[model samples]
Target chain A: MADRSASITSQFTGAGLGRSSLIFWALVGGLALLGGLLGDSYVRHIFILVFIWCIVIASWDLILGYAGIFNYAQLVFFAFGAYGSAMLSIYAGLTPLLAIGAAALVGAGIGVLVAVPSLRLKGEYVALFTFAVHLALPPLIQQGRAIGMGGNTGLLGIPWLNLFGFQVSSIDKLTWYWVSLAFGAVCVYLIYFVILRGRMGLAFIAMRDAETFAQAIGVNEYKYKLLAFVVSAVFTAVAGGIYAHYTSVVTPKVLGTEFFLMAMVMLAIGGMGRFPGAIAGVFTVVIGNELLRSFDDYRLLLLGVAVVVTVIFFPEGVAGAFKPKPPEKAE
Target chain B: MSLENVTIQFGPFRALTDLSFQIERGEILGVAGPNGAGKSTLMNVCTGGLHASRGRVLFNGKDVTGFKRHSRCGLGIAQTFQIPTLLSSVTVGENLLAGQMFGSEARGSAPDIPIQDILYLTQLEDTLNLPASQADLLTRKRIMLGAALATGPEIIFMDEPLGGLNAEEIVEFLQVIRHVREELGITIVMVEHKTRALAEIADRILIINFGEFVMLDRPEVVLNDDHVVEIYLGKKHDA
Candidate 1:
C-alpha cells in the first residue's frame, strides 16, 4: 500500500551510508588496487582466486546469512556459470564476454527452477533438495560426453576473457585479479546496498524470525525465498563464468560436494552472513591453503583443525564475533 | 462481517461448534473464555488461518469462506499474534514498512496511508530506529499492532494483546486500543483473558465455553450474566 514515493526512496536512497562504513569500503578498494603489485603471478593467482571465491561466498551470504535459508545449490550455480560460458565460447564460437553474460542468465534460470519447487520446504528440506540437485548434476554432465562437455575430464582450453581483444588471462594473474576484484566489489555492493536496504530485505528478516507473524502481516514467504535464490544465483553464475575464463577450463570438480563444503567452511569461518567476513574467510582459507602447501597431503588436515577451532571459539564466524554497539540514545 | 453457523473440527475434537456472530462496522468486539475454550480458534476462522468445517463467512457483503489467509488480508482483514511477533533484527521503521505492501496491490492505484501516521498513532514516533528486540514488552505489542494496521485493514484480529503485562501496562494498552477505535474507526476482534480491562473498551463482549457461545451481549450484560460469572469471572470482577 506504500505510495510511489516511499517505494522510490526505499529502493534508491537506502538508509544513509555511515561515514565509518564508507571509509571501510574505501580502504578495501585501496587494498584491492594494491593487490596488482603483489609480485609474482603465483601470489597474484592466489589473490585472484580469493576474488573468485568472494563472489560465491557473498552470494551464499545473501540466502544463508541474511535470508536465514540454508541453500546448498549455490556451488552448482557457480559451476553452471563456468560450464555455460565454457560451452558457449568453445562450442558455439561466441565471444568470451557474451558467453559470460549468457552464463549468468543460465545461472538465474536454474536458480529459479530449483528455488520455485523448493520454496515450500524449510531448513533441512531445502538443503536436501538443493543438495540432491548439486550431487545429481555432475554425473549428468559427465554422461554428456557427446555434448562436447568432455565427460569426466570436463571441457578444457576454454578461451580467456577478452574485452575488445585484450585477453584477461591466467598467465597475467594481475589483470585477472583486478577483474575479479571489480566484480566481487560490485556483487557485495549490490547485495548489501540494494537488496538488504530495500523493503525486500526487511521481509526476508521478518520471514526468518517469525514466519507466521510475517504471513499474518502480508510477507509472502515463497516470493522472498525465490528472490534470494535468484539474486544469489545470477551473481554466482557470473563469478563462475569468469572463473572458467581465468582457469581456461570447466570441470565437474567445480560442482563437487567438497567444493561446496570448502566454500561453506570459508563462509562460516569468516561469518556466515557478514559481507566483510565472507571476504575475510576467502583470504584466510585461500592463503592458508597456499602457505600450508609445503605440508602436501596434510594441508587439508591442518586446515580442518583450524576451521574446527574457529567454529568452536567463534561459532558466529569472524564477523559474528563483533557485537553491534547498542543504538546511541536508543534511537 | 459475520459468521453463519460455523463449525471447526480437528480430527475427532470439535474446536468450535455451531458458532454464529456478526460484527458491526467500527465496533470493538471482545472474546473471553478459559484455556482451550476455542477462543483463539474463533479468531483463527475470521482471519482465514483456519477453515470452519461448515459455515460461511461474510465480509463486506461477500461470502469469504474460501479465501486463504493472504487473500483475506488483501481484502482488508489483518491480525496480530498471541506472542509478540516483531522482527527482532530489523529497526521498528523497517518492520512497519514491511507491512505496507501485503495485499496492497489489490486496491489498484490507491496510495497507502503514510508510515509516519502509523508511528504516531501507535505512539512509536521516537522508536523508529530501535531494533524490535530492544523494545520493552509494551512497546513490542504496540509495534506489532501498528504493523498490522499499516496493511490498511478495515478490521484487525488481536489474540492475547495484553498477555504478560502488569496492571499499569494493561491500562496503557487499553488506552491505545480505545484510541485505535476512536481515531481509525477500525473494527477489532480482541481475544483476551483480561476481563476487567476488556469490559471497559469493548462495546459488546462474546463469551464462549467449549466452542459454543455462552452469551453475546453488551459488555455490562455479558459480564453480569450468571453463567459468564460462574465460568469466566467467578465472583470478583477480575480474571
Candidate 2:
C-alpha cells in the first residue's frame, strides 16, 4: 500500500537504512558458505536449482510485479534461451559460456519482437497475446526438426559450462554450485540495483499505478513497457541458458504449464513488487517441492492449495508480511 | 496553440463539430458549456486523449495532429482531470518528480523550474513526504496542479479543476492557477462550469452549446450575452 517498489528501491539505496542491505549480504554469504561445506551431491543439485530459479523468478517479477504489465510470455524467453544456447553450443561449436551470452541476446531480440505489437494492446489484451505466443512456441519448435531441435524428445547432449580451461562437467557438483551462485548473484544485482534503482524503475511504477496520469505527465508508456520486457527477458534467458547447460538437456517441456504456474507461485508467495521477496519465494517453493516428493502425484494438488492459501491469507507474499509499516507523520 | 476546423465524432453523435480556435501564449482561457457541450472533449483533443475526426492541431506554428499523448506532453502540453489521477501509492514529492523526470525534456535533464518552486506555488510544500492517496481532496487537487506545473508545459488544459472544492478552496486554487500563469508565463485552458469563477481569472471565455460555438470573447462580453444566458438559464432569460 505504501508503494512497495518505491520503498524497496529506497531501502536499497538509503544508506541511513542499511538494515535490508545487511540482510541481503548475509543471505548471499550464507549461501556461499553452505555450498562450500555441503558434501551431498543431491543437496548441492537442489541449491543449484534454487540459484537458477532465482534468476527466472526475479526477472519475471520485474515485468509482472514491478512494471504491472501482466506479461505471460516470460517462459518463452526462457525457452528460447535454452534452445538457442543449446543449438549454438552444439551446431555452431561455440563454448557453452559464450553460447549463454549469445542466448541472452536472442532473448532480448525475441522480447522486442513480442513487445512491439503487444505493448500497443491495452491491459488484458497484452497478456492474452503473450500467452498465445507462449502456448504456440512448443508446437512451433517441435516442427523445427530439420534444425536439430529433437522435436518432442528435445535437444540432448548439450555441453556443460566451460570455466577457464576446464569444462564444468555434471560430476563436479561443487564447481557447478559455486558458478550458479555467482551467476545468480550478478543477474539479481543487475535487476535490483542497476535497473530498478534508477529513474527507469520510477517510470515503471508510475506507469503501473497511474497510467493515464503518467502519460499525461509525459511518461511514454510504450517505451517504458518495451524496456521492462527487454530487460526481464535478458536475465530470464540467461537463467534458461544456465539451466540448460547445468542439466545437459533442452526440452520443449520446460515451457509447460506446471513450470509457468510454479514461477507464478514463486512471485505470489515472494510478494509481488517487493524486492528480494522472490528469492525467499524460490527457497520456500523449491525446498517445499523437494520435501513433498513423497506425496507423488498429489504434489501438484498440494502446491495448488498452498498458492490458494497464500493468495487468500498473504496476498503480498512473504515479503509483504515483513515490509516495514510507513512511519507516522510528525505532529 | 490552435485548432483548425476540428471535429470529433463518436458513432452518430458529434462531440465537437467544426470547432476552430486560436489560443495566444501566456493567457488563461476559460471554456464553458452546457452538460453535453463538449468542453472536456475539446480539452481531450488538445491533450491527445481524443483524436480529431478531421483537422489539424498546431502548437507554436507546427502541426501536431499525429503526435501521441506523451509526445504532446514532451512538446510542453499537459493536462489535469476532473478527478485528480495521482499515483496513489507514491509520495507527493515523487509524483511531482515523475513529471519532472519525463515531461518537457528527456530523462536526466535539468528541470526548467525546480520542484520546490512548483510546490511553493501550489501550496503543497508540507505534503511532500505524504503518499498521494493519504492526502485530502483539496491537497490531492493541488498535487495534481503541482505535478502538471512540474512538467514545465507551455499550456495546461484542466478539465473542471475546481469541481469538488468549497468556495475558500476554489479561491485558493484560482490564486494558484493565476500564480502559475503570472510567474511561469504558461498558457492555461480551463474547462469550468462556474462562469463566475472563470470571470475572476479568465482573459477570454469560449462558450459552446450543443457541440457548436456560441461565442468567444472577453469574459464580460461573453458572460452577459443574451444568447449565452438562454443557453444556460433558458428562453425566459433571453426574453
Candidate 3:
C-alpha cells in the first residue's frame, strides 16, 4: 500500500495541482444576474429572505463547521445586531449604512463577552454556556422593556436603508433585496474566500480535526477559538443589519433557538465544510419550506421527512452530494 | 527541556509523585515502566499537557512550568501520542503542512519547511497526497513522527512508538529515530513497556515504579540490576 501510494504520487508531478475556479465564479455571476431579474415582486422578497439566512448561516458555518466550535449563540449574536441597529436608527437617528457598522461592533462586543469564558470550556461546555445565554436573552429584553429595548414586543419602525435621499422602504422592495444580496455576497467572500482559504483557515481546520495534536504542533487554541467567534459574529451581524432594515422591524422572535437549528439544518443539507453547501442548504430548506407552506400544518412534517431522507440518502448534504471527487490515479 | 520534583494529580489520584530527572542534551533518554507506572504522565508533564501540582519545568534557562502545550511547542518540544493521534481527515501532506505552520517557531510564522524534505526524511515522500488513515502502521507511525518533526522541535517525546510493529519494522523505525537525533541533532525521550527495541536504541534508560523514580542507568546495567528485573524487567525477560 505504501509503495502503491508512493508510485501514485510520483506519477503526479504537480503535488498541488491548481484548478480554475472559473466555473464557481461563473455560477455566482449567474445567480447575481438572475436575482437582478426577479423584478421587485414577492418572489424577490422570498429570495432576499433566503439570502439573509444564507449570510447568517454561512457565518455560523465558520465556527460550527470549520472551526468545530458548536456555538449555540449564533442566533443571539444576530439578534444583537438587529437590536443594536434598530436602537441606533430609531433613537439615535443614524443612517442604515452607519448603523450597520455600529451593529457589527455590538455583535463583536457581545461575541467577546460570550467567548471569554466559553473558550476555556471544552466542547459541550461551550455549547451549553452559549445556549444558556441564548435562552436567557429574550426574557432579559422582555423584562427590560422599561429600558426601551422594546422587550417582548420588539422594536418597530426601524429605519429603512437610504439610497441617496430616497429611503428604500417596503413599497420599494427591490432596493431591500439588493441590500440583502450585497451584504450576503460581501460576508460570504470575506468568510469563505478570504479567511477560510488563507493560512488562518488551515489553522482552524487543523484545530478542529485534532485539538491536542494541533496544540502539540503549536496552533494556539485560544487564538483560533476567539478568531472563529469574532469573525463569525461580525459577519452574522451584517446579515442582521440588513434584515433589520429590510423588514423595518426588530423582534424578540429572531432570538429563537430555531434560527440556530435552522442554520445547522441548512448546513447539514448543503454539506458541512463547503461554501456552496451553505447557499444550497438555505435554498433547499428555507425556500423549499416556503413553497411547501400551502400544505399548512403538514408543511413542517413533510419538511421533517424530507430532511430525514436527505440525511439518509445524502449524508454529506446537498452540496456534498454533488461535489466532484478528485480524479483517481488510473486503476 | 527538563523536570524538577514534578508532581501531577488527577482528582485524588496522584499520577506522578515527586518525579525528578535531568535529560542530557542530544541523548535518547528512554522511559520504561509497567502499565499504570506513570511513564506517559512524566512525558505529559514535560510536553506541557499536564501541569505539575508542584515543582518546575525548565528549558533554555527559563522556567516554562506555567506555559501551555502550544507555548511549550514554540519552545521546541514536540510529542507523539501513544494511540497515534492524527488529523485523519486530511491528506498526509496537508497534515504535515499544518504541522509546519507551528513546526519550530511561534504561531503566525510563515511555513518555510519544504514538504518534500520532511517527507524524504520520514520516508513518507511518496505517501504525501494519501489520506493519513489509509497509511499502513509503519507509514502512519512515520507520519506521526514526521508531523512532530515538521514543528522543528529540539527535543521530541515518543510514547510507545514501537507498538504493534514486527521485528523488521521495529529495526527500521529505530533507524529513523537514530537518524533524527544523529543527523538532525534533535534530542529524544521515548516511553515504552518492557520492549527490548526501545532498550536497544536508548542511550540511557529511566525506570519508575508507582510514579516514583526507581533508577536511572545505562540499559545494560539496568537490565542486569536486581531491582529493575524484579519490578519492571521481570525475572527471565531479556530483549
Candidate 4:
C-alpha cells in the first residue's frame, strides 16, 4: 500500500503534469487496480482501520492545525457518534445505516454544544473546556439512568448494515474497507480541495495567525471558529461510526484518553495543519506501533520518546523535510 | 464624520472621554500626541479594533460601530500597527497573499496581483520569499506597508510608520508613503510623534491630548500653536 506521504506527493504533482486529463485518468485507473487487489479479508481489515483513522486525524488537523484551536476532547465527539449509533440501533430499532446518520447528527449537535463555550475561549481555556468534556462523557454515559447506555458493559448485537438486499456482515471486511476508503477520500477532498481552497480556509489561516488582526479584517472570529469545530466533529463522528460497525461493539473504552493521545501523536508525527501530514502521521504511528508490538510495554515508552524527539528536533515533521525549498537567487 | 460622546474607561483610568472628530474623504489626517495620549486607542476605535463604550463610528455615511475589523477594511478603511505585525512564519509573498485574500471584495477569484509588484512598491522585491522573521527592522516595516497595500485599501491608517527608522530609512519610507498616496489616490491617516516629519507630508494635523482633540488645523498652524509648543515641544526641551 502507498504510504500517506507518497500519496500526497503524487496528488501534489497531479496538477503539474503536462496533460491534466490524462494524468487524472491514469491515476483513477491505478487506484481502481489497487482497490481490486486489496479485496482480501485480512488486508481489507487493516485498510479499513487506516481509512477510518485517516478521517479522524484529518478532522483533528482541521481544528488544531488549521484553526490553531487545541481541542483535547475530540474523542468525546467520536464517543458520541459510537454511543449514539449503538443506542439508536439497540433501543430505537433503527438499522446500522440510520444509526450512522444519527450518530453524525448527534455528533454535530455535540459540536454545537462544545463550540458555544469553547469558541469564546482560546489557548489554555479552550483546552480546559475540551478536557472537561473528555472527562465528563464516559461517566455521563455510564451513570445516566434514562439513556440506559448499558452502564459499563456497553451496547452489543448492533445489526449489520444492509444495502439493497445485501447484509454487510462483520466478516465482509473488504466491503467495509471500500466504503471507508471512499468516505475517507471524499472527506479529505472536501477539506483539502473545497474548504481549504475557499474563503473559509483563508479565514481559518487569518484567525490562526492573529485573532485581533483577523477581526480587524472583518472576519467574525466566533462564527468561523464554531464552523471549524462543527465541521471537524462531523468528520470525526463518521469515522467513529465506521469503527463501531467494523468492530461490532460500542463501549466507553473507545473514548479513552489513551486513544485521544494516540490521535494527537499521529497528527504531531505527520505534520500539523498540512492535509498530507495527517494521513502520513496516522499511518506512521499506527504501523510503527504494530511493528513494535513485540516489545509490549517497552513499545509505549519508545513511542513517548519518539514524540518528544520529533517535537524537539523536527517540529515540522517528516513532510516538512520533503517540502520544496524556494529556489536561490542568481548571484 | 462624527463620534457622539464616546467614552472608554478601563476600570479607574479613562482612555477616551466624550471624544469626537470628523474626517472627510481624501483627507490626510495626522494624529499627533505623546505616549498614553490614546492616539492608538482612538485609531483602534475608528477602525473597529476596539469598540468605543458609548459612541457610534460612522464610515462613508453609515454606522460602523458593530462592524468587525475586516468589515471596516471592506468599507474602505485599513490600518498598520504601531509595531509591525507581519506573520513571522510565512514568506513576504505569502503575507501579501494573505492580505489580498482577506481585503479584496471579489470573492472566489484567486489573487492574481504579482508578488513582484508588491515588493517593488515596498522596495522589497529582493526579499520576496524570505521569512518575515528573518528580515531586518526596516525590511519588516516595508513588508508591513506592502501587506497593507496589497489589500488595495482606499484609506490606510498608519500608526507610527516611522517609529524606529534611521534618517535614511525614514526618507525611504516617506517617499513610499508619498508614492502610495499619489499613485493609488489612497487617503492616509498617520499617527506620529515627529511633528516636523509629519508636517512635511500631512495636509491636516489633529493634535490629541488626554484623549481629547486639542487642535485640528493645517500642519503648520498646529505645529506653531503656543499650546502645542508648550505641551509637546516643552516636554522634549525639559527632558
Using lDDT, give the best candidate's number: 2
Clashes of each: 0, 0, 4, 6
- Native RMSD of candidate 3 (Å): 4.2
Note the DockQ of each predicted structure.
0.42, 0.45, 0.44, 0.33
- What tens digits encode model 1's per-residue C-alpha lDDT throughout A168-187? 66787777778878887777
Off by over 4 Å in 2: A1-23, A326-331, B104-109, B237-239
Residue-level error in angstroms, candidate 2, position A324: 3.4
State the lDDT at B104 in candidate 4: 65
For model 4, state the Cα shift of residue A50 in Å: 1.8
Work out the TM-score per prediction.
Answer: 0.90, 0.93, 0.92, 0.86
TM for candidate 1 is 0.90
- C-alpha lDDT score of every prediction, in listed order: 0.82, 0.87, 0.81, 0.76
Q: Write the per-residue lDDT of candidate 2 for residues A210-260, one digit (tens) a residue.
A: 888889888888889999999999999999999999999888999998898
Identify the CAPRI category of the predicted complex in candidate 4: acceptable
TM-score of 3: 0.92
Q: Estimate how well candidate 3 is docked, as a DockQ score.
A: 0.44
The sequence of per-residue lDDT tens digits that candidate 4 reaches over residues B62-120 is 89887767777766677888788666655666666666666664223333334455565
Q: If ranked by TM-score, best first, what sequence of candidates would result?
A: 2, 3, 1, 4
Q: Who wins the DockQ comparison?
A: 2
TM-score of chain A of each: 0.90, 0.92, 0.89, 0.87
Question: Model 4: clashing residue pairs?
Answer: A216-B69, A216-B70, A217-B70, A218-B69, A218-B70, A218-B71
Order the candidate numbers by DockQ, best to worst.
Answer: 2, 3, 1, 4
Candidate 1 chain B, poorest ten consecutive residues by summed lDDT:
B102-111
